[model samples]
Target: MTPLPVRIAGTGVHLPPDVVTNRRLAETLDTSDEWIVNRTGIRERRWLAPDLATSDMCVAAAHPALAAAGCAVRDVDAIVVATYTYDQPLPSTALIVKEALGAFRALTFDITQAACANGVQALFLGSLLVRTGAARRVLVIAADSASRVTDPEDRTTRVFFGDAAGAAVLTGATTPGTGLLGWDFGAELSYDVEIPAGGSRQPAGATTFADRRHYLKMNGRTVWDTATRCLPDSVLNATAKAGLTVDDVAHFFLHQANLNIVRAAMDKLGVPRDRAPITVDRLGNTGSAGVFTVLHKGFSEGTVRPGDAFVVSAIGAGFQWGTLCFRA
Candidate 1:
């Protein structure tokens, strides 16, 4: 039997009220707002309060998403929380969110390692659960507390990330030829972006703490090269897989990693600049939440119309990248 198409029933987002502007960052760092903006195009980003964790963001995001979907907590059959900056490793962040949301009947999942691409992966899993009849409604939350992982004084990594969470409710699309239609997911192993310690390979200890090994490390140049190439290609591949062309896609929701990267990908695709919605300038790089932020914006503001085709894509620390083409 042909599987049903997964529809994004509703979406919501939670950005901490605490805003960190580039000028504020310059108050402590050696760099200025001009330099940061010229390079990253990030003028400001939200920071979770010192007291909160990743799960807090997830739970906050889930409320409105479930409400928007008209789904009760008990009706959510599965909860997928995607974040590398989990509250901790032992109890599982998904379970924490599920418990907080009072979703006792939901099966919880954590996509803890995908970094920025975690949102795409979570949405993929949500689609599968609905398409396979394993779930009627799935709540997928992508969030990250990047401030907790970056060195407080490192200008390189600290300036580029923010804390945020975005939630989506997924179900089978009753309309034929709508919902998740085609996808292209691919990865190439690379450690150019990683946290050097805090796993079984190197347990958390005084030495790792002193060296800041738990903090995320990234090669900006490598990220630039890889994202510029892989993202556009993946979009083309996925669009083609759906038997559509670039022109057929009404909106492009690429990972909100960098404004320049987003522009470059669109340039490579020969797509116009306005076709993609961007939230990185105000939100910075919210890791897994980036895609959701943009998606929520497009959706809430009525940009994503019915019968229109759209493409969502991203890349992560595992060098994993994917594109999902959908009709709504």
Candidate 2:
């Protein structure tokens, strides 16, 4: 009566056709392409088209995953999408994706608004469903269009976000330690000092518009300090829980939020720089899609192998941070 293992059967991604390059943005902001590239390692990123939304990208990405898994959407028992930027206000993107994928039997829901950490969070949650025998298979999708939240006038924020979606199918198996080994989550809610004019507390209005409340605002320095301090420990803790050391992990799939942040965490964790798989140079930060986007890149390039150990981690909105250790 032992529990089953959760195995990732497939991975897929969808990036909008539009490419927003740093050079293109440099034409608007006071920043230079070199600065953005040196700091973030992002030369260009995908942006959702005017007609597309998070659900659209998720649905598109899900199709390939469903195909790879060799199952119809109806075979999934659950759907989970991790994103704060949904196409609509109600009904959840999970349901949107469910209908989009023609999923009929799955229970659907969304997860934390923890910006970049979401992809891994969604994956970890989906694993629980299969591991507990509550689900035969689950669809975990993370998609976001941060272009709307970014303030075009703010050089720092403007160059950091883009749009993309990634999907994974987790199926139940009789194998041991094949999927998620362990995960750890941490939060610093006091840093909830977000732009106060967008939500119910201060609904968007003329006054809010005047204050530019719809844009994403953050205590960037503070978050940087916290991430530099918190992220490594989260990785270490999760690795320890998984009964592995930093050296034991073959590839690191840290959040692709920024080049500096990833380097800092690898330095702090004492993991070699080359150990991490990265894609920010071309994808920017896809919010919750960051981890899987990198995962997809690695998979597409045939670099990831079966039995390879990996460390996936992130820190973002809500000042949340966490990590998951898994085997490919």
Candidate 3:
């Protein structure tokens, strides 16, 4: 079936007020600011307050997006939230966002598999829903409090994660061929990045808590290698599907996973450095919120101009990854 056209009308991001500098981490851990910067290219990151949760940040981001889209809460037809951090396990964070935004009419759910790629995955799903006539307008949000799950004692993980939220409003394109062009998503069947426990398989227990199995875990080398190889391929595949090429993309909104990883992918795809805007240096890897956060920053800074064609790509836990192409 021919899919309907979809476009991103507006984008918004909310970062917690608390800033954690590499120096601050170094003060407690055995790592230094220089070491972290040289390794991850992250200088500082925002950590959410103990009192706040993922839904709070999602609501904070959603308001600006709806306003920017000239859309009201009542007008939204569906809400898709991408996050692994829910305040509780029962009611989905998407529903919480819908209630918080007072968008009682919207169908709400959550998507959690893509991990850091959740934002792009949500965008793809929202676009499909809008295109299929299942929804006229969709509010797609990705929020995460990675700090809450990060083990401070684990310097490797603690130094790289932070808290943030990002959102976008998607709807049918006013002009055809001016929105989403093509996308590709896939999982490579690996657990290179994951939280080992807390799910039904291991359910929370004393053993899990003592082992810190609930905290986020990663095989950094595996992720780096996998992303370096897969991200560029995904982008190329999606663009080719749309009858475009790497040179045709005006901007690149790749995941803010690591500075080196992004640089490697861009070099491999032959995308010049000037064409990609990165936010990981200051924001750290915000997990699912990273892609949209970078996109929102570009739009606000006027670096992403109207009629620009951009590619969004990410690799996350569950060995999941994807690429999305759009015309702004």
Please state every model's RMSD to the true fold in angstroms: 1.2, 2.0, 1.2
lDDT of 2 by residue, 123-190 (tens): 88888888777888899998889997889899868898889999888886555557677778899785
Q: Give the candidate order by descending TM-score.
A: 1, 3, 2
**What is candidate 3's lDDT per residue for 233-269, written digit by digit as tens?**
9999888876789999998898999888889999999
Write one digit per residue (lDDT tens) for candidate 1, span 1-328.
2334888888999999999999999999989999999999999999999988999999999999888889899999999999999998889999999999999999989997879999999999989999888899999999999999988888989999999999999998988889887898899999999998999898999999999898889999999999999999999999888989999999999999999999999999999989999999999999999999988998889999999999889998879998889999
Model 2: ten consecutive residues of lowest lDDT: 1-10
Clashing residue pairs found in predicted model 1: 307-328
Q: After superposition, how far is residue 250 of candidate 3 from its true place, in Å?
A: 0.5
Model 2 reaches what TM-score against the true structure? 0.95
Task: Report the Cα lDDT for residue 92, model 2.
Answer: 81
Better of 2 and 3 by TM-score: 3
Local error of candidate 3 at residue 54 (angstroms): 0.3
Clashing pairs in 3: none
- TM-scores for the candidates: 0.98, 0.95, 0.97
Better of 1 and 2 by TM-score: 1
lDDT at residue 54 of model 2 (Cα atoms): 89
